[model samples]
Target: DCSLAAEQLKNSPRHKAYLEGVSLRQLQKLYSLLKGHLGGESLAESLENDKELAKRKSIMDELFEKNRKKKDDPDFIYDIEVEFPQDEQLESCGWDAESGEEI
Candidate 1:
């Protein structure tokens, strides 16, 4: 069924263009999600068994929507840099402490 659906999409011109815009990393991530959802269990049963996965999927969906950009968009930038303002003092972690030994 999945292969048939894929073949149908491949044959469709509209879907073929859409698929061309999708990256391999995105496809791999989608395949991973589908594998988790269909791993020998019903959809509802799988969702009930792994609430964390459902939560993660929702978060990822939200992030994807928030950060989505079109290839032809005039405002799209290849490398974006964002800096978050720090309002609190920086805390030192054990790993970041002075090791005292020179390499």
Candidate 2:
């Protein structure tokens, strides 16, 4: 993903204009610096399946029920969603074009 993002940004006229005389290497370094600030992917492979998700929901429901008795907020609600990254996505981001391996 980082590599793709870098490529797109490098090709973008606005990005080029903004950076002015910055070299390709410097732009790449900038991308790496900014990518770190976007936060990491949230993935627990064990929790990707429906069965595991249901189990997790059940545990959360129990905890919420217990907390309900101590609180008076009836409008409160909790929701959870999990996503599994695709192979192409993993490759585009995980594999560094320059290094030709997972970063």
Candidate 3:
């Protein structure tokens, strides 16, 4: 019922402003974290049997927990710009290359 909780929070008078101040990308990330928390489609299977998925989920959870900020937090910035350093050469994708034929 994560979605339900989110809906309730969104509609709550006390939290409505805080949610409104949050960006769509932040909300999406929250949704992703919540979905991961729910164990996704592998809920029926034991996490021990799906070590890879569990590991990925663990990493995601750690990252989200480490980086998450509340809308009301004094240090919370509405916008943030982060540049990731690329040490390796970029690979070109087929979809990114233009077809020679004109439309």
Measured by lDDT, the strongest candidate is 3
Which structure is stronger by TM-score: 2 or 3? 2
C-alpha TM-scores of all predictions: 0.28, 0.31, 0.29
List candidate 3 stretches off by more than 4 Å. 1-49, 80-103
Ranking by TM-score: 2, 3, 1
Question: Which one is best on TM-score?
Answer: 2
**For model 2, which pairs clash?**
1-92, 1-93
Clashes within 3 Å, all models in order: 0, 2, 0
Candidate 2: stretches off by over 4 Å = 40-103
RMSD of 2: 18.4
lDDT of each: 0.69, 0.62, 0.70
lDDT of 2: 0.62
Candidate that beats the other on TM-score, 1 or 3, i.e. the better one: 3
Prediction 3 global C-alpha lDDT: 0.70
- Give lDDT tens digits, candidate 3, residues 9-99: 6778998887987755555546656566576534434333457777999999999988899898899998799998799789999989999
lDDT of 1: 0.69
Q: List RMSD in Å for every model shown.
A: 14.1, 18.4, 14.0
